[model samples]
Target: MGIIRTTVITGLLGTSSAAAYLAARNPVISPLAANDPIWASKVFKKHNPSRNPVTQDVCIKRIPFSKIRPELLQNDGPLALEFCRGVWSGWGFAVQRRYLDFKWRGPETSQHLWTNEQLADSTYEKGTAITDHFEVVDKTPSAITVRCGDSPRNQALRPSDGLFEISATIDRQREEVELRLKSCLFSSQGKMDGVKGPMPSWMEELHQWYARIWAETGSWRLLK
Candidate 1:
């Protein structure tokens, strides 16, 4: 195991607000945009453009996508994402993301530079593990898209076809967002080959569950 992996294991399993996410009480989140054709039509596809590429469509109902702060959706920001990283523990996996660097090329460009400090997790810790590096591939007041690259640790292991990507967006005119995720083991091997699968249904359910917790944090959520 790497020093980075060893150091974050505990953090992944536990946090100061570990129990906060499990709390029963929460704020009222708007219902999914049942009538918004724009949101209904939006789709998420795997970034690894291979012959057999994987695609996923995420329509989050637990928390409205519009609820996501545009500022927090960028590749890097003033805030540290505070959502429960341990939400996946029930699935026998753990996840955490910490920013390494943030840069803006210029005022004239929408491109922003971002580096992730940590992307190790137990889900792919075996010979199939992967790392994460992200860039703001696209951005709008309504959306942010990011792509994940192999970490040095990952390339040493699954070097041949380890890559990933994700995009998240909310419509001011809708409730749910289209979340494109290919960052974990669920699709690592298939990333470059374009034979990947979407994150499982259970994982999606857990994300909604965690979204409830993240939503409850209110103004204290997803901010610096």
Candidate 2:
């Protein structure tokens, strides 16, 4: 019994070490800044009044406007769509999707999972559901915000309801275009109240790690 317990402990430690290494290597996702203007936006203000520390996160990439395609510079719609396509398609996302499928919590309709040309027709209007898991909750000339993870198909699969957003906008002060992915998880009460039941630390850490990997690889693919 002692030997068995030692072996199990060793295996668990090895797994945790590997996960930590991966997260450190790809640290892209980060906590949203306290003073970020998004907090003032009508959409964000409505959902996260207290700014629950455990529930919200953002991933960002900044690229010089000169490097951005000229056609996308003036058109926020195309820029957002293209970036989202890149966001959902990459080796990182592919690996995550496979894991979800293996766990039997993945999309029922594989055809509707990733980027498809049909998304090009999005009107970017409020309340538009796209690609099954994402819905456009807010749209402005400068940004588009989507609420993710509440789809009827995946709700049962997820431990909590959450939302994720992809936004691409010009940052005049920096002379760059900032691409950002934002996410928030809600308690069962349909509120950002972590008090109801806090997520396990390991769960949150795993999620952030995968998010960072996906963001890093996706941003690289977008630029390429």
Error of 2 at 1 (Å): 32
- Alpha-carbon TM-score of each model against the true structure: 0.33, 0.61
Q: What is the lDDT of residue 119 in candidate 2?
A: 45
* Residue 63 shift from truth in candidate 2, angstroms: 2.0
The prediction achieving the highest lDDT against the true structure is 2
Q: Whole-model Cα lDDT per candidate?
A: 0.32, 0.56
lDDT of 1: 0.32
Global CA lDDT computed for model 2: 0.56
Residue pairs with clashing backbones, model 2: none
Taking the tens digit of each residue's C-alpha lDDT, what string does model 2 give over 1-224? 12332333244335766656545544455456768666677755554445443356676667787777777777666677666656565555554444434544434645444343444344557766554556677776656677655453543323344556777777777877777667666533333543432446655655565555555555553452
